[model samples]
Target: MFGKTFAGSPRRQRFLGNRREVQPRLEAAKMMDRLTLLPAELLDPKYGVMSSPLLPTLASKFSNLLVDPWESQAALSVLLAYYGLSCVSTIGLRQEPTFGNEKLITTPIAFDFSHNDHRMAQYLMWGHVLKAVDALVDLLQQLDYLGDPALGKMWDRSLIYVATDFGRDKTRPAKAESWGTGHSLNNGTLIVSPLLKGNRVFGGIEPTTCETYGFDGSTGDSTPGLNCSEGHIYSAIAQALDIEFPERIDMSALLA
Candidate 1:
């Protein structure tokens, strides 16, 4: 729904003003409030701020915030994604069987981190991650999770996943802050939902070598010598959400 998210914002007299050195910063301010396919009212930060205890007054606060280009677009996508579901679920409840059943069930509000180097990765972590956090927080609150008679209990059906490619080389020198680190096998993924088996880790990571290990798919036992592939994770989440798959699956280690 956004245009050219990866492209750098160009300079203009109205956006750039006199601070040529801060071209990107000033230009981002102009584009921050740009319109999208989502309704203009839904993008308003004040949606539930006054009535909801979980919401912070953020309407004017986002006006001049110069976020990463991709994140800037993803931030709005987050709202659209959540609200898209909210609209469908609301209308679906009132519609006859096939009338409102044609819409997408949901789509992840996805974004990429430019991990060219440690510094760039850190920038995205600070910029992109925080934006997503805020957007999600707003989503949970704006709909008044289980507070509205119409939308209550929606929380159990929702999930927020924070996934990464892999961890950085744990062996990187402590002083080598600027040195880009290589990918290490060990990493963590965060999934939030009441639907998931809470407070459980499916696999283990070796401390000394930073190597990751697998677990029994049938039973949630850690097997340090064995390794889990990405497929195991896929099966785990798919099973947790009751999503359909064609193959045999028994990764009960990740389900509730």
Candidate 2:
């Protein structure tokens, strides 16, 4: 089994490939037309790294270089991926191109959990959990930035999330001087903001006994065998994304 589930912060629902392939070419052409608009140095540093103007210069110097702008961008993708920068294309979500170039942007979903160990104890030590939440908030902020009159629209709709395989205890296990205190099904929290109607805590927690109870957190408050679980939190996320499934009440909107 997958242990447990919780509200996911900065959840990912996109990826990269062909959509990115066609983007840089159109984007490159756009850059060529705006030659007199502004100097390359004036461009944002991140975007400045790629200079369409130098394609001819580099081509003459290194004949092995691929001349197609998109192909060159693909090479850049390989380089970025090698450095742990994740790349994803929104093409799959939109199904049709509405923007000028249909370009792809890169982003990462970071959590407090350790990549080597999925244990809650290790996760608590990693401060990036809250940092990851901040990153998610920044992502929404960027979306709003593009919506400003100056930058224009970024994405029509964006739904962000924070989730985990299982719920974690607010109390640390080391502080409790106990083992296997992780994977708590009792109660976990999720934070959803601006993208949704409201940002409030959701889900409920059933009382849980210590590890002596065969690692079960059930206080006998619910149906047989169901104990405290993350299913309810995941259900709320699905609903926020407008995802519907025929099942029991996973999350009953305790907060308006």
Candidate 3:
């Protein structure tokens, strides 16, 4: 949900979990409370305060700490769930191993590239996207995350997959940019993963009509009349993640 509003702007992501205020403080303490094993009924899914199930137990204990409430059952459920986590973690639960410690975090990034396709003609659409990618790569390099064995970094373990709803229409003659275009099925996904054969395009764009052509899944060769779907890419990802299915496209050629 966090991203820079403009191209090349100095803004950054918001990480207000540790703030003294209510929301941030509670948000920061959520995981810790669970780790410490708080004894609250609301933490259980059957009696959760804000969920289809009781996702947190300590809600009953802390709800009274806050005054704002539209219903009698509100404060007790919320505060206990929020405050209990913080108190437990700070009291001596959030700790790292003596010699071995590792963490794996994942998040998704979204772009405003829906019907606002008019920005494509102005170069603004790709501008911010490219800049954001550049910044991410820079950070990865600084942290030695891009396959740096000498520094003991994870090395190619991280993957960045850029998805699109669909492609824009090819109505505009080959190279002529247009104001807007309808969605088309001729689109491709951009993936940055060590588990794939990098720097390769499984499909090619036809220059005459500016259309995309799929490739041969077996040989990874461009096939003009061929067609592929998002499911094919999903199969490739599954291969990389060591997942299995009874039926899937033969996309082994894309994997590393």
Q: Give the candidate number with the greatest lDDT.
A: 1
Residues 156-249, candidate 2, lDDT per residue (tens digit)? 2334444454544455454566445455544445445444446542223334532211111222123433443445545555655567888634
RMSD to truth, every model? 16.6, 16.8, 19.6
| Tens digits of lDDT, candidate 1, 16-132 | 455665666545533333323233444566642222121132332232223233333433444343434232111101111111135321122222133334454455344545555
Deviation from native of the Cα of residue 8 in model 1, angstroms: 38
Q: How many backbone clashes does candidate 3 have?
A: 16
CA lDDT of every candidate: 0.51, 0.37, 0.49
- Winner by TM-score: 1
Q: Which stretches of candidate 3 lie over 4 Å from their true place?
A: 1-122, 137-152, 172-180
Q: For candidate 2, report its TM-score.
A: 0.36
| TM-score-better candidate, 1 vs 3 | 1
1-256: candidate 3 lDDT, tens digit per residue: 2344443443321233224366665565463443332344335655443332222322333232122121112222232323332211111111111111232111112233334434442264354344434433433333432224465432244445656666767766567665456778888888777778988888888887788888877789998877777778878777766779987777888888
